[model samples]
Target chain A: MNPEMLTKWLIRWGGTAAMIAVLTAGAGDGVAQESVAVRAALVTGTLPLDDPNAAAWNNAAPAVFPMSPQVHWPERIQQVTVQDLTVRALHDGTQIAVLLEYADPTEDPDDAAAIEFMVGDKKAHFAHGQPMLLVEGGPVNIWYWKSKDNKGVDLWAKGFGTLRPHEHQDVKAKGEYANGKWRVVFSRSLATDHPDEDAQITPGQFINIAFAVWDGRKDDAGQVIEKGSQKAVSSWWYFRAEPPPDYSGYVYAGVAAVLALGFQFVLIRKLKEGQSA
Target chain B: MGRALIRPIVIMGAMYAFLKFVLPNIPGSAEIPASLIILYLLLTLSGIIIFETLSAESKDAFWGPMQRFLTGENIGGLQPLRYGILVLFPVLVGWQTYNATAPSDSPPAENRVIHPAPPGEYTGLANPVPKTPENIMQGKGFYAAFCSPCHGANFDGKGPAARGYNPPPANFADPTTIAMLQESYLFWRIKKGGVGLPIEGMPWKSAMPRWELELPDEWIWKIIMGEYDGAHQTPRTWE
Candidate 1:
């Protein structure tokens, strides 16, 4: 083929194809941002609170993620034993509940655990050492649990290192250890008066959450080190909440637009030929 | 000479503009960065010009000057122009590519200086182990386990964990890098590590751990030797 004719044909077809792809891919950009998709199960009845073998959780697929050792204090620890964690979530119109389960060879006598939730639209750094509640700007809600105290506390933070317990707790937690595995549940209302302070989790919207777990058994010299400071004492991972059923309409629209452009280009070329003749 | 360059230079410049302005915004297209597009266009066009000049039709253009002047005969007016372009075009494209892509050979800036000169005992310390096949093999094993995680298996600064660090790990493959330092200099750096590196900017930010805490003095020397021999890189010399 003549180089000029070949170049012209290549440009027209290639440009049209490229335009269609970019528009289609750009439309579903938000869907791509979600790292973890926790399906919001349509629970018609009461959620099983105490039952470990609940059927509602059967539909909720587990998202197993690895824990990364804290990077801040490289001198304190070189490696961490707690490597894997599996999480599942379900929602009943009014409340959202998440189940976090992880394996531990030896359950510490302290049996202490903490989970943090950030309630905003902005992307989170989920950095190590500093409290994520502080790294997440506006407000973050934290739930702290200890088996020795037999109590869980709800805390709030607004900046880098500021963490304070709320006068009233907003999170309820129940935990159990069986066969060297720890399963804990955290549940809260869909809507709350302190929307600013509480993470307003709703179906179909994606929000960022950071996880930190401390194994008291791994502590050195009776000093239980966890949270903030990248060491074996603490570990962090970032998970973005995604609702069930993938909806990508932009990709379809992009295909339709490309077809229309191709049709129009042919029509225009025919008209130009007729006028020249 | 100036007149002979006009056509090729203009064509190259236009090709650059086409790649930079028109290519990046094309949807569904491989969106190469503007700088990369320019480099690609220059290299390609220069290659084509050279390839086309080598053909039978352009033979007079390449050898015209020698044939015409020696025979005392005036051939076509195109021979001088073709010879000039054939001689100059490749050098121009090669120089541009080298300038754009090659690593800067200048010494590190003041703020980037991780460690200064050695004080007393570390000045002339040499590697105790001879560069026998066994010792080099052991050094290679140790380096793969430790240094390769951040310094990269190829001794480039692009290891898996090297991404987030502020100042990236040293690339041993760079000729100006480890090739400039002595064995004793490396020994001090390995023993004292980043802690010995004084706080100039953000202190304690050095990702390098003091190997003294992790490995003995013998292994450090072995790692240095293995890197030079294994990667086949030129060692730094007093000369």
Candidate 2:
């Protein structure tokens, strides 16, 4: 065969092999996330404030976020007691409620969980908020719940070791332990009276959120373990109240298609003129 | 002539699929930035266009079908194909534009130097500790206590604390990371941590704790060796 024919054969076989490789490999888009946004499904009537196994929760989608040990600060846990937390959210126009469920074999007195949201426009660091000296916008609104109290406290924090209860305690919570799992519900108003201290939940908008859990265990002597910053925590995730479907995206897509077709017509006219010439 | 017209498109599409999809799925492979992928495709397309149009015969071979299609010439039995192209091309363009312009919650693209130049003083410094088995064992213990929380017990940078970190921890198992850097550079990085990065490493939000304050210099060297052993990688030689 001639050199040109040999080159053609090589190209043909090489192209076929590459096509096969691509097809067999499959299109695996490796964009992995630890947790998806916890969408608060819109519901009518009263929200499930205290019911963990309520039938209404089936309407909301569940998202499980992997929890890590709080190892950044001096008081940190070396071993992770809680591996992950399953979260579901629901909104009743007036109030928003979130259910946090995690697995723990023992129910010590210190078994507690908390959900936090960014208080300002700027995002703070997810782990215990950001240091105030280094940067601004580190304030967070925390809804803290404990099994011992069976209640939730509305708290605020600017950074590590700065957690303080808010003057207006607007958050409420209930907890139930069954089947070796702790299910806690934290509920608050969608629009709080104190926006400065609380993270106002707006429909159709995403808000930065994080979670922390303290798994208390007792020794043979029945002494409660020290559970402070040494707890299982999750990085920043998103919480958004599901909004009604809008048709704006379809309109934008239609306009773009029309513009592209118009450009193609101009290209066809240019090609026709060239052919005539 | 028809084959020539489709060859370049096929090549471009295959390359895009490989870069955007196949590469990331490969174990121990870092993600190729979308901007870098676009740059590569543009360069490949430009080269192909220039080569195809180098001669009159080749130019005719390459553009003849395109010209005919646009001008609606000699499309005799290809009426359905012509209509299909007319509908699909605009829709494809619209879909691509929507994907590019749509709002997403994913973080914005970041451009930062991964391995910046070490300072002159640290460049000549060598590991003070010898690579003994006992020392390595000690280093492994220290790593489990100090580094494993974020760098991971397996040295793959997926430690439990690694979530939500924008840059994440460095995966030593990847050849592009520790295997590519000199031991001195690793020493400086470990000693100074993220706060010690130069201006080129801006937006320095790395959660790496500075070990110089807590660990001895000899222990740091041992930990470096331990990291290499854990990741099954060797430090880059000066030679």
Output the worst ten-in-a-row residue range by lDDT, candidate 1 chain A: A128-137
Tens-digit lDDT track for model 1 on B1-239? 23224555677788777776777678876667867876788697767568647877664454444444323345467668755654455445545544555443232233645445664777777789898999998999998877776678888876655543445577888777777778888787767654455434222334565678678989999998988886678566675
Model 1 TM-score, 2 decimals = 0.43
- Largest TM-score belongs to which candidate? 2
lDDT of 2 by residue, B1-239 (tens): 29888899899999999999999999999799989999999999999999999999989899989899767798787867888898998899888877766555443344777787877877856778888889888888888888987889999998868764545789999999999987888898888775566645532245566678788988888888889888899988877
Off by over 4 Å in 1: A1-35, A50-53, A73-76, A122-124, A128-136, A218-277, B1-239
Q: List the residue pairs that clash in candidate 1.
A: A18-B27, A18-B28, A19-B27, A70-A230, A71-A230, A129-A228, A129-A229, A134-A159
Q: What TM-score, over all chains together, does every model reach?
A: 0.43, 0.66
Off by over 4 Å in 2: A1-34, A44-46, A92-94, A121-123, A132-137, A190-197, A200-205, A255-277, B1-141, B148-174, B183-213, B216-218, B225-239
lDDT of every model, 2 decimals: 0.60, 0.81
Question: lDDT tens string, model 2, A82-194?
Answer: 88899999997788999999999888778999998988676565655554222354578999999889999999987668889998999999989998999999998889888
Best by lDDT: 2
Q: Pick the candidate with the highest DockQ.
A: 2
Q: What is the lDDT of residue B65 in candidate 2?
A: 90
